[model samples]
Target: MSNQLDLFHVQRAYSLAQGPLSNDQLYQSVAEAAGLASDALNQRCEIGRAKAKRSPLKRKIRWYQQTLKAMGVLRKVEGRRGVWELAEPTDKGLHQAPGRVCLLAYSTRLGVAIWGDNNAVFSHLDEPIHLCVTSPPYPLRIQRRYGNVAEHEWVDFITQSLEPIVKQLAPGGSVVLNVSNDIFEVKKPSRSLYIERMVLALHDRLGLSLMDRWPWVNLSKPPGPTHWACVNRQQLCVGWEPVFWFTNDPLKVRSDNRRVLEPHTDRHRRLLEQGGDTRVTHYGDGAHRLRGNGFDTPTDGRIPKNVMIKGHRCSDSLRARAAAKRLGLPAHPAMFPTALAEFAIRFLTREGDLVVDLFSGVNKTGMAAERHGRRWIASEIILQYIKTQAELFSQFEGFWLNPALAVDSPDRTGS
Candidate 1:
């Protein structure tokens, strides 16, 4: 029932094209290598229908080219119809490039993207990072191909990757980690304690202080733990992930709630217009009191609650994936929403402060930083991801806004 587009075939075509290839040459190469239908490869729409539709496979490949053009990697040869030229060699199986760290790309006066393992990259970085925001691979029972570890080893893996970067944090710098909450115990309905264990490890082993745990609510999140949730009905669908905020020094943590405030609700606005509560009231069993004067003073905006709501889809990410498919490229397994990164960047760091993402999947953190006029650095291990995420900075690098806001501006893109 799910006819999802598998990008693997598209990426294969790019891998086979060592240099410029004619339309037929590239199509044939991909069809042969991927064992695609010869008819699908050679199928041509009628001249009238050509503008309206194309063979599904061919159309996908062609549309992907638009993505490549944006990334500045693939281009149609000037005056050579049906011919294309690759700017540089594509990732030959997504292997590491020859170097300790490679500066893959950058935005004008914004940020730098580097290709290398995060641990290795951070070791050589001399600049003190003001914020380290990232979502490392979750600890799942079965590790994914993108280098996530087994549940038992997840803590150690993250600890090692972050230990060096934590040492380099500025005095009041914060580390906000987006971690998985759906991990369950082996063959049971019980949840795993890895999150708690991770918190302890960071505090005990790294000497960091726990600041606050922000809940990222995604109501549109699909159901999971098929065996327990759908079959046995032992558990409910998990709709939120925990975002743990930590800092090197709790008292001096660099954050301001006023910077990331939520718009006032109509009811609250009416209350403010009426000149405060008008009467003193006691709530919480008389433990707390609300005075009329409290609502009389006007403020810029309401302080946002800790529960952040956003969908997973990001416009830039969608564009990157489409481009990646066109170029026959692979993507990071999981990419957090752009709004989430923007929230953290705005709340924790100031303009021109350095923000770093150790496990910069598709470099969403870097994109958020650049949009907010903050300096950024990203380190990702996969060369293909480095290439794919590089598309974010291709055009409108400094002036781009979070596209998620374009459609869902209220409630911060809450579904």
Candidate 2:
């Protein structure tokens, strides 16, 4: 097959140098074309096959040839056989210099690559991303500082800077913003209401529709003192972070399958254990069996509700520091758990779909995409962070490493 293809290319090149040929001329003059037995060609092309492989290479070649013919690169007459011809080079940007960043695509393996800055990413993407999951830096003066921009400034960044990238997204693509309200102890008022209003402003101003809110319930302790001594001491602060899901086109955003499942609660379990009493007779045998066993059987996999528990913390904490030392990389502050990213990716995208994260903090989303066998593009603003993340990622052969690091490794504990 290789030899045949080589001969075909050689013959075609030579024929083009000479002149275009008729069907008979092509078949007679071209070495491989002349050598290709009609019966064999028909069999290889699957012209007479009852059942053909879906998206076969031979069919792809035929389609390519047809497209070339349509574009006047090949000569094909109605009721006549097709003849190949070289396409004339156009003086358009087709001959212009290629972009700096180039992506090498694959069919099987997930595409994982990191871009350092916004400039590096905007022009290099081959396919528009279907889903983008990110949590941008809040207005809080935290461990690290990207900028000290005010609320209005951040809103402008979303509308002016990020909106362009959002426009590049596919018609049905979605953006999930996992931002939290800023708590200013000095002010003594929650900034959540202001942030929520800003989010609404962005949606309305940018023409993006709000799909839903995913509440991230934080089980961690709150900082600073409260008015009441008891309230301050035993404050079971139920911190809820808002995750706003937005879409450029609502119709295009389909349900994601990776939505979190509600585990059976203790009350539900107790009811199931007792089953229905003599007064209450279960209709279905399966229902009765489930009730008798004290287990709540799951219904269909539906879209996940707004509220979600903070199953794992982001990469910046002490836990992440330990994991990073064990894994041999610098800990990232904004890394979302792979589980969360996986859930969102599974629900929002099909197999082989592209996922993009503009604020690629720690590359968690990219790692998740790789684990789930989906392609992803990640862009981080900070160069140091990009280098750190790349080095960390390069250590692993796959998405996750084996023998997961202990929560309290000595090196991590020291940090």
Candidate 3:
């Protein structure tokens, strides 16, 4: 049922490699680790694609290599263009090379993939990422364990953060940012223009183009019961947030509508069967143009609209609660739902593409990527958030996992 590929496995293989390897050598290592023949990677190359002239296998490996080189793990072997060698993970597993700083989490599930800090990590990536699905901690009203900038400065903070990210995108790659607007002035509930300001800054200052704006409709959202909604009743409860899609070049964005089509409505089926609804009606309030309530059916499911409805309940699962209890960790109160991450990933990227999430709390994006077969590089400042969630995605962990991998396990919470 999942329309995903094994991208996670490929990246994991690269991470676990003992030392620097040529592109062919890297693919063979990943393939062997994945329980496939060394030549199994050829299947990806056999299929031609509109976007990439190179084989998917080679492109995927190039991404892996760039990630390694950018992270200061690989370098051209003294003068060879194609040959490379490892420059990091000195026995201690901390990546202390020049131009890159920060100790790696050394996770088993895709070992050596979980990193920290975009400031230290992004500069190390030499290739453009295919997609980036992230739920950035925007300016919010409530205090959180994961910090955010003050409301007044949030727009600038978001814009500045994205500057590096934009440079990391592949030519046809896109970014889907999940951000919620806050009530900056409770006195003037609707006056929070920071989201708008952030959007403008991304476009005007950063030279990024807005591809589309999606409205995430969470039906199971809890009521805020704020002064305006519950007390004065001046505004309705805001149950939706914007998921903005951006790209370096809007004219050539990589998207597959067939990958994320919605089921056709009964009305659509019946109308096409009856060969009816050809009549036109007034279009909205203007009453100038005309349209029909129903029309011919789509061959498959209907093309999805920008308004995506998800009923994922906001409750801790028994497994999550139990893990939190056993590990002495608290569940992440503010985390992106797996379903939300799944939809964005399915819509924007293909199998074998490299996806990155800088804030990677609990790595919902990583989970989605694993299911869909995309390699992901997820990083979080807090090591425990990455550790506690590892159990949920155990298949991707390293083979010779460290016994002390749980060293950061105690008293860890807030994924």
Against the unseen true structure, what C-alpha lDDT does each candidate score? 0.74, 0.53, 0.65
Tens-place lDDT per residue, model 2, 111-189, is 5554334445554456677888877766554434333345546676556546656767788777887775544445444
Ranking by TM-score: 1, 3, 2
The estimated TM-scores of all candidates read 0.73, 0.55, 0.67
Which portions of model 1 show Cα errors greater than 4 Å? 1-93, 96-107, 396-415
Task: List candidate 2 segments past 4 Å from native.
Answer: 1-109, 123-126, 141-143, 183-193, 221-238, 257-303, 313-330, 395-415
Clashing pairs in 2: 256-347, 257-347, 272-294, 273-294
- Evaluate residue 11 in candidate 2 and report its C-alpha lDDT on the 0 to 100 scale: 30
TM-score (C-alpha) between model 2 and the true structure: 0.55
For all candidates, the clash counts are 2, 4, 13
TM-score for candidate 3, residues paired by index: 0.67
| Preferred candidate (lDDT higher): 2 or 3 | 3
Number of the predicted model whose lDDT against the real structure is largest: 1
Better of 1 and 2 by TM-score: 1
Residue 258 C-alpha lDDT in model 3: 93
State residue 25's C-alpha deviation in candidate 3, in Å. 47
Model 3 misplaced stretches (Cα beyond 4 Å): 1-101, 106-115, 274-298, 314-321, 397-404, 407-415
By TM-score, how accurate is candidate 1?
0.73
In candidate 3, what are the lDDT values of residues 1-415, reduced to their tens digit?
A: 0011132333344447755566777767766654655454665434455544445655655665565566555666766658776654333222223344443554433323454566566656776788888888877777566666788888777777666777888887888899885455756756587778888888898787888888888867777546778787877887887888888877778888999988878987787778647777665686565455345444777888888787645332344556556655556656767777788788888888878787777777777787787777776755346555665555563523222233233233223
